[model samples]
Target chain A: MPTADHATGSYPRTARTTPTRAAQRASWDRERVHGILDDGYLCHLGFVRDGAAVVLPTLYARVGERLYVHGSTGSYPLRTASGAPQGLPVCVTVTHVDGLVLARSAFHHSVNYRSVVVHGTARQVTDPAEKAAALDAIVDQAIPGRSADCRPANGKEAAATAVLAIELTEVSAKFRTGGPNDEPEDRELPHWSGVLPVSVSTGAPVAAPDLAAGVALPSYLTAQRSTNA
Target chain B: MPTADHATGSYPRTARTTPTRAAQRASWDRERVHGILDDGYLCHLGFVRDGAAVVLPTLYARVGERLYVHGSTGSYPLRTASGAPQGLPVCVTVTHVDGLVLARSAFHHSVNYRSVVVHGTARQVTDPAEKAAALDAIVDQAIPGRSADCRPANGKEAAATAVLAIELTEVSAKFRTGGPNDEPEDRELPHWSGVLPVSVSTGAPVAAPDLAAGVALPSYLTAQRSTNA
Candidate 1:
C-alpha cells in the first residue's frame, strides 16, 4: 500500500488521521472517501458537549470535498458550533455495513464494512445562499433529484433549519471487503465459515396518507431502488 | 410523553441526555432503548481524544443493562480506558434507518430511524469469566446461538482482545416513523409525497474458499435473511 499523502491528490495524513493498527484497511484516497460518503445520507456527528462526548445521527451531504450536515437550529451541535469563535471541533462518520463475516473461530468474526471518519472544526453555514444550497444538497442526497421536485424552503422554514459545514481536509476511509480471514489452524474447524452479505434495499414506496390525488411516484425514486448499496 | 426515569424501570435522563428540541421523539423507556440497541451491531463510538472529539465505527453488544464493546487490546479506546483510574467517559450510538420521507417541501424531508444514545464511563473488563461471557454475548448478538457453534478463543487470542463495559445509566432513544409530515398547505402541492421504505436485507451466504465441504449453512443464517431488519 502506498503511504498516505498530505494532498497532492489525497487527504493530508495528519497525526490523528493515521491508523495505529490494521493499517492495511485504511485509505486516504479522495475518490474512495467520496464514494463511501456518497453512498449514505445519515452520519454520526460527534462533538464534545459540556465536557462529554455526544454523538447524534443526522443527515449530511457532500459537495466536492466539503460536507454539509442538516440539523435544527435549536439542536445542540448547531447552536454550540454557531457560538464558537473558531468553530466547534467535531468528527463526522459514515458507515455502510456490507456483510457479516462469521469465522470458524469467534476471535476472527467481524463485519465487512466501508466507513469514513472526518475530523474538523464545524462552522455553521451562516450565509443564506450557501445555507439554501446545503439544504438542497441534503435533500438530493437521500433521493437524487429530489430537490427539484419539492418546494424550495421559504424564509421562515429556512430559519428553522441549520447547516454545519466540515471540510474533508483530515479524513480517512477504512474498510474490510473479503470473506472471513480465519487462522490457518482454525480453517479446518467444522463450523460454517463465510460472508453473509447484507445491504440496504428500498422496498415499494408507500405514499403519504394525505398525498394529493394526482401526484405520481417520481422516476428518480424508482431508479434509486433499482440499485443496491 | 412521560418524564425520564433515573432508573426504576427506565434509564434516567440527565441534562445532556434530555432533548432540547423535538421532545416528543425522545424516550427513556428501558425496553424501547434495548430494542433499538439490539437492532444493530455496528455503532459509532465517540470519545474525547487529545482535546478533540474522535468517533470510530465499532462492534458492540448489549447484555442486560450493560454494553460490551470488542476491540483489539492495542486499540486506542481500549488502551486509554484501561489506564484511566475512574474509567473513560464515552458515548455509544446505534441507528437503524427505517425509511426515507420525501415531503412536498424540502424542509420537511426526513429519515424514519430508531436511534439510541448511551453516555457512560467505560471500564475495561479484567475478570476472565466475565470477559468470556461478554465475548459470547457479542457473538450471539450478531447471530444468536453462534457462540456455541464456533471454537472458543484460545488463551493467546483472548489476550489480544479487549472488552470495554459501560453501564446503561444515562440513555435516550429517539425515533421518527410514518410518512412525510408536510405542512398542510404544502400537502396539495404538485410534488409526490411518500416514504421510500428501506431495510437491511441479507443475501445468500458465500462460503469461504477453504471452507470444509461437509459444513452446512446454519439454520439461523437462513432465517435471519428471511426477516426484515
Candidate 2:
C-alpha cells in the first residue's frame, strides 16, 4: 500500500515520479513537497556530460512552483544551459538525514531521511526582473530576509551570473522516520538498537572583521538560530 | 596559479577533476580528499538513464582508494552496472556545509563548504569476501565501529544486496572556508556580514522499544557523538 496522501494533490503522478521500491514512502503532495524543498538551501544538481554523469553541489531557492539555481555564467554547465534553445534536462535533489537507525541486524540498518527529487528541463532566465528576483531569493535562501539588507547587484555582476529555472512538474518526496524495521527473528539478538538523532546545528555567528561600526546583528538571523536549530 | 598540491600524489589529476572556476579552492592532496570522504557517509550518485540524468542519494564508504555504494540488487543503477561488462560510468559526490556566509553585497554571498567529487566507472562486487568487507565498511562509515555490534547479515540477506565499487583515481576536493569575500568597494556598506557556523550535531540516543534487556548503550556510539560534534 502506497503511503502517498490520497493522491488528489496539486502535483499529479507521472511515470518517472513513481517508485518501484519503497512505494509507500513516495509522496505526491504539493504542500509536503514544498516543505521539504524549503527546509534546505543546498542541493545536488545532476546533469549528463558527454556519455557520463556529473553531479555538482550548488545553492537553490524555491519560488511558488519554480526553482532557481545559482551559478556563474562562465561555468561549463550554466554556459551550456544558457545557449540551449530547448533547455537542459536536469535533476535537482535535496536530502536531510535526520537520524541514524541502528538495528539488531545489519540488514535492517538504515538512516531516517527526508529527500525531495525534482526532474525537468531547465532554462536560463533572461528577463532582468526575474533574474534579479532569483538572485535575491538565492541569498535569502541561505539567510532569510537577507536580500533587503545587502546592496542590490550591479549590472556587471548580474551579467556575469546565470540563473536556471525549473518547474516542480515532476517531483516526489521519500522519507523514513522512527526506529529501524528489524526482522522479528533478529529482535532477540544481544545488540544495542536505537536511533541516534542527527541534525544541522548552528554556532554563534561571527561578525565580519570589516563590518561597519554602526551595523548590528539582524533580528531575522537571531530568529533563524532557534528555528533552524 | 592553480592551488593543486605539487603534482606528485597517490592519485593523478584528470581533465574532469581540474576545476575551471575557483581553481584556488580545488585540491588534489590524497590525505585531504580522504578526510572529506571519511567525514560523511551520504553521497549523491549520478548516472544516465534513458538519455536523461538521474541522481540518487545513497550511503557510501571509503576503503583506501576505493568507494563502495550501498544498494539493493533490484535497484536500477546497481542492476545495470552488474550486467555491463565494462562497468558503469558514474560520479559520486559528497558535501559538508561548514558555514553560511553573509556578505555586504548580494553578489558576494556564498557558503563555506567542503566537497569531494569522484568521476569513474563503478562495477558490482562479485567476490563474496570483498562484498562482505564492503558491507561492513558501509556500516562503519555511518557509525564508526558499528559493524561489529550488529548481527551479521545472513546468506539470504546478503544475496539480495549489491555493492558497487569505484576507485579514487580521478577525485578532487573543493573547499571554501573563512568569511565571505565581499568586493573592496562593498566592504563599507552598512551591512552586518559574517559566517554562521554550520555542522552536524548528534542528540541523545533513543533506545529501541524492542531492545533486549541485557543490551546497553555501546561505548563506540557515545564516542562518535563527541567526535562528530
Candidate 3:
C-alpha cells in the first residue's frame, strides 16, 4: 500500500476520509494508485444526461491524483459538461486483470481483478500546458514509449479534442485476486481444481502499411512487454 | 456471438437498427459477445436517481442473448428503480483486456481491448420464476458449474435479491487488438515497443475456514481451472 501522506497538495479537496464497507479493501495509497492505473487502460465514466444515468467507455490516464480523459469535442456529455455550471459530477473507474477464480460452484466463481473508482466533478482543462501534459499522460498510459512516436497534435487537432481533468478525490479501490474460494463440502468432488494462469504478452510489432521502408522499430517499442505484478 | 433473439418474451422495443460511429467498431458481430463478456466481469449500470445520473459497478452474467444483474433489495437505486413509475433507463457496458501499447509518442499510444455496450430501459423483473432463472444465470455467468453446486435460494433469500434482466438488443461491440500502431518516423527511437498481452486466469481454490473438516470440492468447481473464453 502506498502512503496516504504522499497525496499532500495533490489531493483533491473532496477526497473521502471515512472509508466504507465497499472501500475497505485497501487505502488509496500510492502503490494502489499506480497499480490500479497502470494495470488497466480503460475506464467507464458515469454522468447524467437528459435526466438519465449514462455510463460511457472511454480511455483515461492517471497522473498523481489527477485523471485525464479526452474525447471528441462533439461528444454531447463532454461538450455539455465542459460548460456546465457545477462541472460534471462523474464516476470514473479503472480495472486491472489479475487472475480468474474457478470456484467449486458457479455461484462462488468470480474473476480476479483490481479496480479503482473515483467520484468527483470533472472540469475541462483549458490551459495549453496542462492540456499537453494530460494528453501525454493519456498517451503514455496506453503505450509507455509511444508519446514520441507520432507527430504532436497540431493546434487545430488540439482544439478539436476535449480534455477533462478529474481530481482523484473520494476514491475507493476494491480488488479480488488469487485463486477460487470454494465451499468446504464440495472439496471432494471429482474435478481438476488447480489454477490455469492467464497472462498477456506482447508479440512482434507490425509496422503500419503506410510507414516508410527505412523506419526501424524504436527500442521503446521493441522493449515493451508485460510483467507479472 | 449469441443470436439476438430473446428466449423470454421481453425484447427491446426501441433498439436502433444501426449503430452510430461512436457505437460502431472495427469488429462488430455476435461471435464477439462471449469474448467481451468473459474478459470483463464487472459492468457499470446507469440509472437515474432523483433526476440525476447514478452509475454503479455491479456483477453480471451473460446467458445467451440475455444479461442478468442483481443486488440486494436494500440498495438504493435498485430498490427505487424497481418501483419507479416507468422503469429506469440504463446503459450497461463490459470491456476486455488485450494488451498495453507503450508508444514513443503519447498521441499514437493506445490500448487494445474488446468492449460491449448495451443501451435500454431496465424493467423490474417481477415474475418469480423468471427472477429465479435470472439469478441462476447470474451465478452461472460467474462460474459455469456453480449453479448446480450451491443450494438454490430459498424463498426468503430470493425475496432479498433484486434481479434485472436485459436482452442483448440495441447492442454494440467494439474491439482494438494487436500491437501498437506507432507512426513511421519515430521507429528508430531508443525506447522499447511492442504489446504486453493481458489476461485473467484461475488460481488454486481457497476454502472458507468455517467449512467442515472433510468437505470435498465439487467437480463443477474443480473443472473451472482455465479461462473459458
The candidate that wins on TM-score is: 1
**Per-residue alpha-carbon lDDT of candidate 2 for residues A4-85, written as tens digits (9 for 90 to 100):** 3335665778777887678888887888888888888999999988878899999999998899998888777798798899
CA shift of B2, model 3, Å: 12
Arranged by DockQ, best first: 1, 2, 3
Q: Which stretches of candidate 1 lie over 4 Å from their true place?
A: A1-7, A224-229, B1-7, B224-229
Interface RMSD of 2: 0.9
Q: Write model 1 residue lDDT over B62-159, tens digit each, in one string.
A: 98889998888888889999999899899999988888889999888988889999999999998989999999998888777899999999999899
Alpha-carbon lDDT, every model? 0.88, 0.87, 0.64
Model 3 score (lDDT): 0.64
Specify the highest-DockQ model's number.
1
Choose 1 or 2, whichever is better by DockQ. 1
Say what the RMSD of model 2 is. Answer: 3.7
Task: Write down the RMSD of all candidates, one decimal each.
Answer: 3.0, 3.7, 5.4
The predicted structure with the larger lDDT, 2 or 3, is 2
- Give the least accurate 10-residue stretch of model 3 chain B, judged by summed lDDT: B9-18
Model 1 Cα displacement at B221 (Å)? 1.2
Clash pairs, candidate 2, are none
In DockQ, how does model 3 score against the reference complex?
Answer: 0.32
- Give the Cα-based TM-score of candidate 2 against the true structure: 0.95
Model 3 chain A lDDT-worst window of ten:
A9-18
Query: For model 2, what share of native contacts is present?
Result: 0.85
